[model samples]
Target chain A: MALCNYYRKRKLMDNLVGWWIRLMVFLVVALPLFITASLLSKSWLILGHISLPELLFSSVWRPLAGEFGFWPFIISSLWVTFIGLSLTAPVCLLSAIFLTYYGSRRLLGFMQPIIDILAGIPSVIYGVWGILVIVPAVGKYLAPMLGYESPGFSIMAGGIVLSVMLIPFVLNILIEIFRTVQHDLLDASLSLGASKWQTIKHVVLRKSFAGMISAFGLGLSRAFGETIAVLMVVGNVVGVPENLFQPGYPLPALIANNYGEMLSIPMFDSALMFAALLLMVVVVVFNMISRRTIIYLESRQ
Target chain B: MAMETTKLSIQNLNLWFGKQKILNNINIDIPENKVTVILGPSGCGKTTLMKTMNRLVDLQGGARTSGKIILDGEDILNTRRDIALVRQKMGLLSQRPTPLPMSIFNNVAYGLRLKGIRGRKKLTPLVEKHLIEANLWDEVRDRLHDPASRLSIGQQQRLCLARGLAVDPEIILADEPTSALDPISASVIENQFFKLKENYTILLVTHIMRQARRIADKVVFMYLGEVIEQADVHEFFNNPKQKMTRDYLQGAFY
Candidate 1:
C-alpha cells in the first residue's frame, strides 16, 4: 500500500510540472500575438475616424486641429536609422576582424568589459551626453564648416548619437560571429599562401555573411525605435527633413512626447496607439525577413 | 637507390613554447622526389616539427624557435624571406580536410588567383588539370559549382589535395592525411602519393606502421621531441638503430 501511494504521488507531481512548463511555453508564444491584438484594437478607433491613406501620407500633424498625418515622421525615422547604420556597420566589422585576427589576447580582454559597460548604459544618459557634446559640436563647428547656419539639433546630430549607441551592441555580435568561423579554415587558407587580410576577406567574411546580416538587422530595429536620445538631438520639428542638417521628428519621439497630453485632444489617444502599432509591425516584419534569410543561408551550407 | 638530392634540409632545429621544449635539436635530410615518412606516437612533436617548416608555428603565441630550414638552397627561416613565397613552394595537408567556404572549383582556383592569374578561360583548364591530378575530376566535374562542403569526407580530402596541388608547390607536407578517412579513402590517398612522388617530394606523418611500410621510401622515427632513428624504410623496419624504434615497430607501446 505504501509503494502504491508513492507511485500515485510521483505521477501527480510529474503531471503538475509538465502542465506548468506547457503554460509557460504557451504564454511566451502568445505574447507577441496578444500585443499585436491589443494595439490593433486600440488603433481601430482612429482608423474609423480617418482613412488609412490620409493618416499615413499626410505630413501635417496638427493634433488639436484634428489633422494627423505621419509622412514626415516616417521619413525622419528611416533617415536617422539609415545614417546610423551606415556609420556603424563598417567600423564595427573592421574592428571585429582586427580583434579576432590581429589584436592580442590582453587587448581583447581589456576591450570586452568596456564594450559591456557601454551596452549597459541607459539611453537617457546617452541623451544627456548628446546634448552636451554632439549638439554643440554640430552647431558650433560642423554646420559652419560646411557653410550652413543653424542650432545644433538636427538629423545629423541624432544620427551621430544613435551610431555611437549602436557601436557596442553591433560590435559585440560581430566579434562573436567572426570568432565562430573555424580556426582550421583560417589555417587552411594561411597554409595555401594567402595573406592574413586575404584570408579575412575571403574565408572569414564569406563564412559569416548570414550572421552579419542579422546583426545589422537587429541594429536597424534598435535604431528605428530609439526615442529619448534621438528626441533630444533631432530638434523634434514637425516637418519633413530635406538634408542631414535639417531638424525633424521621428515616430517614436512623436509617441513618447505626446503620450502625457494625449487624453485632452480629440482622437489623440488612438493616434498615438496607432503610432505604437506601426512601430511594432515594422520591427516584426524586419525580424521575420532576417530570420528567414538566415535559415536559407544555413540550409545552403 | 642512386645518389638522392636533398630537397629540404633541417639543421639543429630547436623550439620552445614558454620554456617548455617541444622540438629539440632536430636534424634530417628529406630526399627529392621520394616519400619520406615521419612516424611517431601522439604528443611526440612530429606535427609541430612539420608546422615549423611552413612557418605555421609563428601563429602560436609565445612560440620561439632557432633553426635553419633550407628549401632549394635558401634558408627559409630567415626573417627577411617572404613567408608567402616560402609557403607557396610547399603545400600542407592538415589532419582533417578543410575546404574553404566556397564552391569546389573556386577552392582549387583560389591559390592560382592569389598568384595574379585571372579570367575563367585561364583558370578553367588549370583547375581541371589539378583536379585530375588529385584523382577527383571524374566525380566532381559535373558539380564544380556546388559548395565544397556538400562533398563526402573522402571527396573533400581529395578536393583539398587538388587545392594544394594547384599552387604548383615543389614539396607536399601531409600531416596524417588519411587519418580521418575510411579504408577505401585511405588507400586512394596512398595511391595518389605513390604516383605523385615521381615528380614532387612528399613528407607524410603517420603512426600506423603498416601505412609507413606501404608508402615510405625513407623513414624518420621520433620520440619525445627527438629523432630516434633515420634510415631507409626496409632497414628502419628490419634493423632499427634505437631500442625505442624497435619497440615501437613491435607494437610495444604507441
Candidate 2:
C-alpha cells in the first residue's frame, strides 16, 4: 500500500510538472502578443467612438480644438514609400543582376560582407548621417530644381536617403534569389542557343520573380514605416507640398513628434495609436502580397 | 529528311583543366545518321568529351581544349557562327533533365522561339510534330497546357526528347537520358531511339552496358578519356577486341 501511494504521488508530480511547462510555454509565446492584442483592441474601440469629419478633412492636429486629420501624413508616408521603392528597387535589382551574371565571383566575395554591414547599421545611424550629409547637400541646389522657392527639410531628401538605406536590403534579397536558380536550368537555356543575357532574362529572372517581388514588398514596408531617417531629412509641415523640396511630415513622424506632447489630450494619444494600427495594416497587406506571390510560385512548379 | 547530310569528326582532340589533362590524344569519328554509343566508366571524361562536341565545354574559363572538331568538313573552332550552328544542329540532354518551369508546349517551343519561329499557327504544328516523333503526343495531347513538371519522371524524360527534337537538329546527344528512369521507362526511351535513328544521328552515353548493347549501332568504348576500341555493335559486344572492353562488358572495369 505504501509503495502504491508513492507511485501515485510520483504520477501526480509528473502531471503538475507538465502543466507548469505548458504555462511557461504559453507565457513565452503568448505574452507580448497578448499585450499587443490588448493595445489593438483599445485602438479599435477608440476608432469606433471617434467623431466623424475630424478624422477625414481636418489638417490642424490641435487636440483641444478636436481637429485631427491624418491624410497629409498618410499621403506623405505613401508618397515617400512610393518614391523610395521606385528609386531603390531598380538600382538594387540592377546591381544584384550585375553581381550575379556579370560580376566575378571574386567581386561578389568582396562585396557581400560590405552589403551585410550596411544592412546591420541602425535606422538612427542612417538618420544622423542623412541630416549631416544629405540635407545640406540637397538643400544647396535641389530647392531650385524642385521649383520651390526655398528647400528646408524635404520629401525628396528623405526619399533619396531612404532609398540609399534600402539599397543593401534589396540587393541582398535579390542576390539570394538569383543564387537559388538551378545551374542545370541555366545551362539548359544557354545550351539551347540563348545568349548569356537572354538566359538571365528568361530563366533566372523569370524563375526568381516571386522571390524578387517578395523582397521588394518587404523593402517597401521598411521604407514606408521608416521613422527616424525621414524625420531627420523631411522638413515637417502639414500641407501637400507640390515641390519635391517642400517640407512634409509622414505618419510616423507625426506620432513620434506629437505623442510625447499629447499628455493632456486623450483623443490625441488614441489618434496616434490609430496611426500605429494603420501602419500595421500596411505591413500586413505587403506580407499578404508576398504570400500570394509565394503561393503562385509553388503552384507554378 | 529533305536537305543536307551532316557529320562530326574529332581529330587529335585533347582537353585540359588547369594543367590537368582530362582527355589526351583523342581522335574519333561519330558517323552521320547512326546511333553511336560511348561506353566508359565514371570520370573517364565521357561527359567532358560529350560536352566538347557542341562547344559547351568552351564556356568554362580555365578548362582548355586543343583539338579540331570538324563538323561536315568545316573546322568549328575557327568560327563563332560555326560553333553556334553546331550547337543549333545538335540537341543535348544531360544525365538529369533541366526542364524550364513552364507548360509542356513552352518547354518544346523554347528552342523554336530562339530560332526566331513565332506566330502560333507556325509554332503549334511544329510542337505537335516533334512531340509525336518523340512518342509523347498521345500522353500529353489533352494536357499540353499543364506544367511540364507535373508529368511523371518517365513522361518528363520523353518531354525532354520532344524538346530536343523541336529544334529539328540532325544530331541528338543524350548523356545517360534513361539513367534516372525505371526499367519500363528506360525501355520506352530506348525503343524511341530505334525510331529516331531514321532521322537523327545519335551519340548516346551511358554507364549501362546492356543499354548500349540494345541500341548502339556503332560502339566507341572509351576508358579514361581514351578510346579502347571501336567496332560494330555486334562485334564490340560479342567479340570485343580490347581486354579493357571485354572487362568493361563483363562489369569488371575498375
The candidates' DockQ values read 0.74, 0.53
Candidate 1, B183-220: lDDT as tens digits: 99999999999999999999999999899999999999
Each prediction's RMSD over C-alphas, in Å, is 1.8, 4.2
Q: Residue A62 in model 2: shift from native, Å?
A: 2.5
Q: List lDDT for all candidates, in order.
A: 0.93, 0.83
* Clash count list over all predictions: 0, 1
In candidate 1, stretches whose alpha carbon ends up further than 4 angstroms from where it belongs are A1-14
lDDT of 2 by residue, A1-301 (tens): 9999999999999999999999999999997577568657756645676654556455666667666677778778888888888999889988999898787778999999999999999988998888888887778766666556656578887898899899999899999999899876876776677778878887888888888889998898899889998998898888876767777889889878888795677677777777777777777788888889888886886
Candidate 1 residue-wise lDDT at A296: 85
Instruction: Point to the candidate with the largest TM-score.
Output: 1
* DockQ result, candidate 2: 0.53
Across all candidates, what is each one's fraction of true contacts kept?
0.69, 0.49
Instruction: Summarize candidate 1's per-residue lDDT along A1-301 as a digit string, tens digits.
Output: 9999999999999999999999999999999999999999998999998899998899888989989899999999989999889999999998999888899878899999999999999999999999999999988999889988758999989999999999999999999999899877887888889999999999999899999999999999999999999999999998888777889898999999989785988889999999999999899888989999988887666
